[model samples]
Target: MLSEPTFSFTNFQQDAVKALLSSTGISLLAILPILILIVRQCGSAHPAPPRGCRRLGLPPGHSNLHDEFDPKYSKGTSKDVDDKGQPLWRVKALFTHPIKSCAAVELNVADVVSTGFAFDRQFCFAEQFTPDQASTSEEKTQPYWDARTLRNGHYSRLALIRPEIWVPDPAAPDYAPDLDEVRSKGVMVMYYPRPAGRGLSSYLVKLGIALRLLPRELSFSVPLVPPPDRASAYPPVPVKIWKDTPVAYDYGQHLPQSLREFLAPPDAGASRPLTLFRVDPTHHRQVFRNAPRKEELGFQPVTGFADAYPLHILNIASVHDVAARCARDIPRLSVRRFRANIIVQGPEAYAEDHWKRILIRPTGAKSDADAGVEVHVACRTMRCRLPNVDPATGIRHASEPDRTLKSYRRIDPGDPTNACLGMQCVPSVQEFVIRVGDTVSLLETGEHCYIKLLKPGEIVEGV
Candidate 1:
């Protein structure tokens, strides 16, 4: 027989005070002077409230938006302009998939208040930890495992791969769901190397040497451990791994001969080339020279990937422009190394590279006038080396025999070899649908604004 436990307010209060004193007394004492000095310094610096604090009509040091407004705010002025200073038609598209090379869900109605998206990268697959090995007795007895615990610099290789797994089915109405059901399914993972080496198979081999957990060949058989069970625990939902690799876009210019030939047909007899773009290797070299090293760069150690702060935006138009320069009907341009989030379709080739601000909205969602959630494009997307690959075909674009016939063709007898036909530098708009569109007006409270361009060679601030 069990007796019911009783609580008294007096005893509870006494116990609470005792616990607080025991746990925080030393910390509070040590931190009090530091806090006081910080407050005093801040008070003397402005004497008046900071902009965010003033907006709330609070005291100098008080603010409701403190948690919301980051110090990086107030770096620039918002603009409202059109392509030709006339109202231009614009639509917003949101790429719900933040991770590169993953399927994306487009939305007509999205909310972007202050942070990025309402539901951005909400789920991810967890790579198994070494302790998760079945051979380990300690692992067998542990009832649960945390996916985050498995993430560390030692496990950096996991960042290169995205496990092909499916999202777990939500708990049913009648019964709690078993989270492990999703993990039982095998996952498909791909790897991208630091210097852009071979895919997952090779990278795993290198990682195996670093971790000494097992041979690279054994990585496929390992099972990921689950997080410890707690009331507040919200395990990541595993996504299904499609056995086939998704179509990849390489932004870097270097391409392997085999891939290029596969994409480009020797003559018109071949099927339409699959759409792809190659990055300019020379350009990548320049970018890499200026880029900061890993130690100077900020990254999420757990994910082993660079943080989203310094996002790299690639211009679809730029790729289109480069493709147009090549012989007509060149099957595919390679874009292997450059990893990007949202690939846009518009007029200015590489126009996004020169943008100071951009806005993304859900398709058919009411404009900012109606919804408060819209993504604020903070910085320009930078360059990376993932674009270089051997052209699928053995022939180079410039070396093809078709170049002689197509390069000399004249729209009119008077047209020059390098004539600007309004089509030469036109931005490439791929056929994919976007839930959002880019914008120049960061302060506009409504939709239907025009796109504006930033100065060329202007490095995005803080990136």
Candidate 2:
């Protein structure tokens, strides 16, 4: 054993070096095939995702939707121009909320009322009633009966148009051309309880039965003129919205059981009861137009359960611009986030800011362009955290759109805090019908007066 290890140190070192080089060579050879495979895959038409993977994309305020059309081509989708050389800013899409804040119904054509789009925000939900000292708790058990109410405008979440309720009320007018029904019957968002055995038969499912949506024929939030006995029968109710406390008519007395439930939340444990009310047809809330010159735009319409204006118009480019300003890749922003009654394509990003008045014309029509519906671009729509809320998914973005917008698009550049996109609009004519694929012409151009005003406290957030 003493003589056993009499080997030379040099020989041992040489053997160790050879073993290390051989191992290194083997490792490189094994990795070479993998590199070749990756290179081959890269050359293919469609690169395959790794096995066992799901689709992924950026989230809100971080990503953008890849659209094919050129944003500046205002001549509608294609260059079919009107006699005027302006780009055709065609109506990319048209949507109507048979029920405000709920899901919107895509429409080929929709009529406009003095208040807003046909049947939009005509009937909104309120929280359940918790009777005050004037009434007893027994009222909860009574169905289709008069009781105290907590109007939806009083609370944001309750008033929220839940995308979860995306399905159109089957009772609404048929998708086919049915403006006649709108005039003859009028639209009401009704809720019919599922039959007793069918389940959900209660005013609210939490009411021990389930209820489904039903579109009924009822005129609401219009004909500002009150009934002769309105003073005594339909007492003026105190509902809060923004800074104004315009008197609202208590609509509960006339509505059926189905209408009451449809306008109230299903929360069994809520502290308030759903009380239906109508917009004060006589009163109008003025938007604070922060312009150096005092220009008087005629009577503002009374907002019907809407924030401040009757209708809101948004541009797809503006939304995309807001997303691009975001720091990360964002998910495709749905038109629902804008909650716009009208979605217009064409015009560069934020171009609507300068469009003070726009005429919506039928697509490809040359002579009837001027006769088309004219809308006044009232003001830059001031924003809050509302855009951060995804109406489609009901998911809230912690930051963005608003965060990115604050950096660029300010409602009042002087304030720098107000964020806005799109324009608050009201139809110039008393009544008109706007159809999809309509072209929007810039009728009047003016600087957007960023009004230095604050929406009074106790304001509810929108979806």
**Top model by lDDT, which number?**
2
TM-score of 2: 0.56
- Residue-level lDDT of model 2, residues 26-130, one tens digit each, is 665655665455445434423222122221112223312234234443232443554675445777666655444555555566677766776565444433333
List per-candidate RMSD values in Å.
27.2, 18.6
Total backbone collisions for each predicted model? 62, 28
TM-score of each: 0.32, 0.56
Worst 10 residues of 2 by lDDT: 208-217
lDDT of each: 0.30, 0.52
lDDT of 1 at 20: 64
